[model samples]
Target: MTAEFAVALPSVILLLALLLAGSAAGVTQLRVEEAARGGARALARGAAVGEVGDIVRRLAGETARSEVALDGEWGRVTVTGRVPGAVGTLVPWVLSATAWARPEAPGAAIQPAVDGTSREARLGT
Candidate 1:
């Protein structure tokens, strides 16, 4: 019984370490994705490029980086960051996410729906 217990202990510890590493990687990826989305939203709202980058870094981490690309009326943001943990040390896991949004024209008014319903009508006001 002692021999079997000793043999299983290392395996359990290793498995727990792997699980913790995987959880960390997943959380990091989620942070990267949220950062990309926030950056994209800021860009679409006509924020400056520097502001967008700051938003991304704040949402993700100081080590995270962002890229912005604009084509016509659309804006795109990509956020990348290193996964933090044993997994990253062993495998160099780099997680990234991209988000796209259409920039609203400066001072553009909100257009009514295609059906021509006004806000007051929809709200029963």
Candidate 2:
């Protein structure tokens, strides 16, 4: 019995450690995805190019690094992030996540047009 237990113990420990590592990786992936989503949304909303990058970097923080790309003509934003992990033996692993969103065009926003006289009446001064 002792011999069998000794043989199995290492395997069990390794399995548990791998499971924990996998869980940590999954959590990090979630954070990466969230950061990507936030970046895409910011870009979609017409944030400046530099500001979009800043927002993505801040959202990713130290655990991850992110990049944001924008397509002004198509109103599209893409965000990518890499998540780092140590699965075993102090070796690092990287997981990546990406998100995209398209912003509505300016022409889509409808507003009531008012001529000078109507504008004055609406002001009701």
Candidate 3:
């Protein structure tokens, strides 16, 4: 019984570790996705380019990277980052999330910037 237990213990431990890593990766991906969507919405509402990056970083994490650009009237935002692992050396992988949004009408309210400026002042609100 002892011999069998010893052999199976290692496999169980490894499986748990893999599960943990996968869970972390999934949560990180969700955060990145949320950040990207927020950034895209801000951009579409005519928020300043300078502020979009700040908003994404805050919503995601400081380690997250964001790219926002406008194509014609469409805006796209992409966020990429990696989740840290148990021993501090294993990065599961670099994950990316993206979102797209379209410009609103001039009479629409704008989104507030990271700096506390009202959407109305920014002219989207």
RMSD (Cα, Å) of candidate 2?
A: 12.9
Window of ten residues with lowest summed lDDT in model 2: 116-125
Arrange candidates by lDDT, descending. Answer: 1, 3, 2
Model 2 score (lDDT): 0.54
**Tens digit per residue, CA lDDT, model 3, 1-125:** 99999999999999999888888888888998998889887777778756788788888888888765555456677888788688224654888888987777765433443454432212111
Sorted on TM-score, highest at the top, how do the candidates line up? 1, 3, 2
- Better by lDDT, candidate 3 or 2: 3
Model 2 misplacement above 4 A: 75-85, 88-91, 105-125
lDDT of each: 0.76, 0.54, 0.73
What lDDT score is found at residue 119 in candidate 3?
A: 25
Q: Which regions in candidate 1 have their CA more than 4 angstroms from the true location?
A: 106-125
Q: lDDT tens digits, residues 20-64, model 2?
A: 887776776676677667766765676654555566566666534
